[model samples]
Target chain A: MNALSLRNLRKIYNNGFEALKGIDLDVEAGDFFALLGPNGAGKSTAIGIISSLVNESSGSVSIFGHDLRRERAKAKSCIGLVPQEVNFNQFDTVKSILLNQAGYYGLSRKLALQRTEYCLKQMDLWDKRDTVSRRLSGGMKRRVMIARALVHAPKLLILDEPTAGVDIEIRRSMWQMMQEVNQQGTTIILTTHYLEEAESLCRNIAIINHGKIVENSDMASLLARLHVEHFVLDLARPIAAAPVLEGCQIERVTDKTLSVAVPKEHSLNKLFSQLTAQNIEVTSLKNKTNRLEQLFMDLIDSNPIGSKATGNK
Target chain B: MNYSIAFRTIVTKEIFRFIRIWPQTLLPPAITTALYFLIFGKLIGDRIGTISGASYMDYIVPGIILMSVISHSYANVVSSFYSTKFQRNIEELLVAPIPNWVILGGYVSGGIIRGLLVGIVVTLISLLFTDITVNNIAIALSIAVLTATVFSLAGFINAILAESFDDISIIPNFVLTPLSYLGGVFYSVNMLPSIWQNISMGNPILYMINAFRYGLIGVTDVDIQMTFIITGGFIITLTLFSLYLLHKGIGIKN
Candidate 1:
């Protein structure tokens, strides 16, 4: 069964701001689904509804075949939500916060302790268990929030902007931890602006813009359909013109730098051959890491009149 | 612990949050109440004589102590929950799978614990200042605790509706402080005229203060039974409404 299903989800604010407009999505068990969007693209509102935090104006949601409205207790029991904002009882320690989350689910004291220990240790917060949460560093606090969400071991984990304010190293480690968790059969539905992270970690992806899904498909398929491959070239000498290479769209500037796009069916050897033939001595060449930032930008700009997407007023 | 994992977590967080700031939360109130006893009870005892059968010091102790209980309890939850909203931490609980009742109870528990702890300390301090006797231990202790919990929940709800820091101060300054003073904290309701006497009954704190007064002096201007009933009603009603708002995710999830 699908771990989560949203059918015609809609949310209209009191001021008649249509935050989410008839959205539909299904996340199967054990699948890593990345929901991508720019700020204020109705991502938080959608998360609010799915987590039973927001009252949907219309439509229905179900988890493990349980309806959000009807069998809400059963539906919610299987889901955990980590919102984009870093929020925890700052006065309490990491252990107590996890323990409290466990208590909310009605876990026994011994079990809550056991689970709290496991989560804190996994998040590298076990040593700080005795320290008040407010005393932890930004990255450590974010990790505590993650442990709080995972205390109950819910089957469906929804992480919204999980690495928003963390440093790169912590972000990478957190990603690796989430990757391992996702590999362990708990479906992770993530929302982030980090397109490269999504491209690498998620098997499926959805991009939302201006309160609507602009693109949604398998990760590999989405990248494949972009239909353009880009490369960076370092020249021994600077040049100021777009280079001419067979089966490649070349953009070159300055003393020695070159950026080129080759068709997927064509090989870079053609460019090397052309570069050597033209005596445009190549110093170094490299492929950009798997980053879908361009694709995300394209998704947003796809609608020419999508309005200025302003974040939190 | 299963059902209460979330509950215990929220309560512990709330307690730890306040406890970590003892000077700001607990200690000030204890000191203030002590000053009230020294300044009001000692300085003026020679003139006022005694209102009840006990000494004036004994007479005013219950009111001062009850006043502290109501104010601190109400302030703890109000500030704690409002800070959560301001810092955006309440979003964490709003997104959790826990039931509304558990969330409400957990927070209420924190307020009660703080209020009662402060109340206990204040009561012990009051003893050194005067010789006081207990008339009804169970009713007095229960009312003190219940009144604190009820006001804490009400304060939390009000915090949610408030838009700013000024909004938070308006209630405690304009509403709660006035009601508590008029609630017979320093004076008996019988001392008031008929109209004001009836008006005093409407202030829930009167019941609590007067009940505590009765517990200490075996004297009450209002019936202790009615006091119990009022405190009970407020608890049930405030608690249920808070739960309903929580279930509906009022001012948050909604």
Candidate 2:
């Protein structure tokens, strides 16, 4: 069964801006999904509509078999949305915020308290539960939001840029916690600008641009489409010119840096051998950009203005 | 869907919100009410003597209590709802499975609670200055609750239409304060010239104060029956309007 299904979802704002234009999407139960898009690419708008924070102009959204329009309560109850912004009452304590959110979902007081404690512990915020939300660090606040969303234990969780600003350490910890949650059988839908995070965690991915989905496929399949990968190599010594190598294009970025694009059919070993033949010593190498980021950019750039691309696996 | 829990949560949060900041929410009104008794009841009432067979201080007590109910109720909802909107925490409720009516009921109940609590506090202060006797306990209680409900709903409407902090204060400062004063809190409408007395009848607060005054001191300028009609009319109209605003997601949602 699908945890979420969006059929022809559309949203046109009051200011005559069309944020979403007839997009359809589905995430199977217990799947870890990524909904990636650039800024103002209608990612948040779509999530807003799904979460019932924004009214849809037209379309249908269903969660766990409950139609959003006709069975709003059931649909909403099935979703636990961690919005990109920090939206909980700042004056409220951490425990109170989670308990209140649980109560909003109709959990009994005793049950809410229990869930609040469990979620706080899961988020590593048990000690800070009595502190006001505004007093917490930014990363802790983000964790509180995730914990609050989980207090109700909804089947599908929607996280909108849940780690946009946190330090790397906290981001990785959140990723681990999310994986644990997914492993426990809760479907997760994450929207983020960090392609590496999506590439690493999401099994299925969807890239939206200009209010439409441009690419929707499983992670490996999407990455498989990349015929070439770009890597940046740092030289042990300064080089004045680019190296000429077969099946690879190399450009001199700086005195000691070389930018190379190696086709998938050509192994890095052959490129290195060619460079070695030219007496170029390599020190370290890294991808010029995240692998998935390259493909996402390609997909976004390939579609011209006001044009649509087939968004199917 | 556990509407009971949702409703309870919103109400509890609202109550806690005000109570958590007792210095801001509950203190000012008590001090202000005491000052009103000291100045108006003691200083001014002593000179005015009496109106409508009751001591001037005693007659003003009911109006003073009701005024507290009206302003506090309106202030509670307006400030609370507008703060939620301003801070964007209203998304917490918007994304929930709670129905619009439940949301409306929860906030309004919070306002009513604050209004009545302040009313109780003011009444206690009123006792400090003047001897009070209830002409009809049921009528007094009924009018207090009804008046609180009416203002709470009105406050909800104001919060929905308000765009800024200034917008929220405009109605209470410009409209509510003028109307409450002109509602005859310190003076009976009978004291006014015939034309002015007729003009005072146009203010809704006039009827509420008089109805409450009649309940507390058995002295009223307007007919008790008319009070119920006007108060009930305001309640129904404001309730529907508030629910309409919520259903449309005005001010709070995009």
Candidate 3:
């Protein structure tokens, strides 16, 4: 069974704002999925509807085959949501927050305690469990929220911008913890603006814009659609000017680095041979932008406010 | 989901909150009640003497206790729930799988617990001032519980309607405090002119305080049956209204 399914979900605020016009998404069991959208593009609204924090105007939502409207408790029990904001009680201790979250899922005291300890240790918050939540730093607070969401051990975990405010070190640790959780068979859905984070952690992706799904496909299939990739190369020697190479679009970035855009239709062998023929050696080369980011920019620019939906299926 | 566990957790967390900040939540009320008894009952009752068949101090003990219960009950739910809304922690309970009644009962129970606990403390302190007698202990306790429940439900509604911290305090400061003071707490309506007595009958809190006073000293300014009916009716109405708000997600869900 799919971990989560949304069919024709729509939300219209009281102010007559159509935050989510219509969104249909399906997350398979154990899939690490990314839902990407620009600001005010209905990503948070969609997450809110799925978590039952926002009332959807129409359509259906289900978790593990339990319809949200009919079997709300059952459906909610299957999902965990880490919202973009820090919404925990600031006065509450870190330990109490996790325990109370587990209790909300109806876990027994013994089980809640066990899960709380496990989640705290995993989030590296075990030592600071006694501290009030507000006293923690921004990154620690984010980790506390992650631990609270995981304490219930739901079948589906949805994290919205989980690493947004966290530093690199904490973000990496959080990513590792999430990886471990996903490896244990939990279906995880992450919504983030960090395109590289999504490219690194997610297997499949769905990009939403103007409240519509513009692209949904496996990571490989999405990345495979890229026609050209811009790479920055560190040359072994200084290049005084742009390389006059055939079939390779090259521009001088710095004395020792060259920026090159290589089309997928042409192999790197031709570019390397051409560069070598010009008496230039490349020490290191890397893509300037990930394929997902490139496609995301292209999709948003091409699709207007009211346009036909585009998805690879 | 386990309804019992969820309910208990919410109640436990709320109780812990008040207890964690005992100086703010529990102490101020106790000290305030003691001052009321000292000034109103001791200093003022001496000059007023007896109005009902009982001593002046004895006559106001039940009223004093009910007053504390009402204020504490109302204050507990209003402040706690409003803070949850302010801090956005109410979403935790909202997104949980627990039923609406469980959430309502959990929060109301917190208020009831705090109110009753404070009422008991005030009762104990009152003993140092007056040698009180109970005509019907069961009825007295019942009225106290019912009063707390009614006010707690009212506080919940107020919290839901509250948009800011000041909005939560507005009800208590502008309405509740005035009504409680005028609700025949310190002086019976019988002391007023017949015209004013009729107007005092319209105050719902007067029925609650009179019913509680009747339970304590076997005396009442209003009909005991009507008092019970009004208090019971208010409780039922407030409860249904609260449940409807929760179901509709009014003032909570966007």
- C-alpha lDDT (0 to 100) for residue B120 of candidate 3: 89
In candidate 2, what are the lDDT values of residues B137-251, reduced to their tens digit? 8888999999999999999999989998999999999999999999999898989999999899899899999999999989999888999999899989988888888888877
Please state the Cα-based DockQ of model 2 relative to the true two-chain complex.
0.87
lDDT of 3 by residue, A1-313 (tens): 8988999999899999998877889989999999998998899999998998899999999999999999999999988889889999998899999999999889999999999999999888999999989999999999898889889888999999999977898889889989999998889999998899999999999999999899899998989889999999999889789978777688998999999999898899999998889899999999888778898999998877999878777
Share of native interface contacts present in candidate 3: 0.91
Provide per-model DockQ scores.
0.55, 0.87, 0.89
Question: What TM-score would you give candidate 1 relative to the actual structure?
Answer: 0.90
Q: Pick the candidate with the highest DockQ.
A: 3
Every candidate's fraction of true contacts kept comes to: 0.71, 0.95, 0.91
lDDT of 1 at A258: 80
Model 3: lDDT of residue A310: 80
Best by lDDT: 2
iRMS, all models: 2.7, 0.7, 0.7
lDDT, candidate 1, B204-239, per-residue tens: 888888888887778778888898888899989888
Ranking by TM-score: 3, 2, 1
Candidate 2 global lDDT: 0.92
Tens digits of per-residue lDDT, candidate 1, A130-152, equal: 99788888889878878888888
Best by TM-score: 3
In candidate 3, chain A reaches a TM of 0.98
lDDT at A237 for candidate 3?
A: 89
